[model samples]
Target: MTDPLGQQRPIDIKAQLQACRSKEDTFKTLVMLSKTQPRLTAEEKTEDNKIKGCESAVWLIIEEKDGLRHFKADSDAKLMRGVLVAILSLVKGKSLADIQQMDLKAELAELNLSSYLTSSRTNGVLAILDKITSH
Candidate 1:
């Protein structure tokens, strides 16, 4: 299925992530982006609504507006937070079907992320996927 955010699948989420050049750069980018990106209200973010089984605290909020699934995510860990932004940028503004059909593992692998990620980090990615799929 085609991504709802135009024809581009953000097929380069990994490339874009790698282009950050440094983990600090990635974290800075995420923080800056999060500041500008639309966020879910506090009421929309509840403890029970957060992603479980993550080594770090992660919160995800999903909303289908105008037939598009929009995601907002945050994490306490700097690296995880950056990863969250990377993942969110790819899947955000997609249709439910598009999100469901996305092969995230393949995408990440193509981006060469798996080699750099730990088991916990890998699980964190899955947690992000779970949050997206849950909605």
Candidate 2:
């Protein structure tokens, strides 16, 4: 079965992450992606969409359609918005089963992001993952 993105194979998020030459490059890519993401309107950034556990105010929208999950997110912090996009890019438009089976920890480990993430940011990322994977 094909997903909405109509992929013959899963997008290799791990590989994309690993391709980054350095942590600085990763942040550069993240900033670029974040700039492309549309800013949230006041309504969309309300309590209903607010993401908990993030040190900064982050909001998320998760929806299931045609057996696939779709994600959209925003954050007050510039960097967090990029993290949201990265998280979404990895799991968005994937089948629920595929999403549930994803080894997020493994992927993050491969990205070698631990050195760059603070405790709060780490928790925020995990919280975002939980929110996406759960109801």
**Quick one: best lDDT, which candidate?**
2
- Tell me the spans in candidate 2 whose CA falls farther than 4 Å from its real position: 1-16
Cα RMSD (Å) between model 1 and the true structure?
Answer: 4.8
Mind giving the per-residue lDDT tens digits that candidate 2 earns over 1-135? 334564312244445556788888777766765775677788788887888888989999888899988776889887777666667767877887898898987766666466557998889888888888786
Using Cα atoms with residue i matched to residue i, what is each candidate's TM-score against the true structure? 0.70, 0.82
- The clash number for model 1 is 0
| Lowest-sum lDDT 10-residue window in model 2 | 1-10
lDDT by candidate, in order shown: 0.66, 0.74
Q: Compared with the true structure, what per-residue lDDT tens digits does model 1 show for residues 1-135?
A: 234543323545555556776656656655544453444567766896678878887788777999898776666665566566567767777898898898877766654354447887678678778778766
Native-vs-model 2 lDDT? Answer: 0.74
Which candidate leads in TM-score?
2
TM-score, cand. 2 vs. native: 0.82
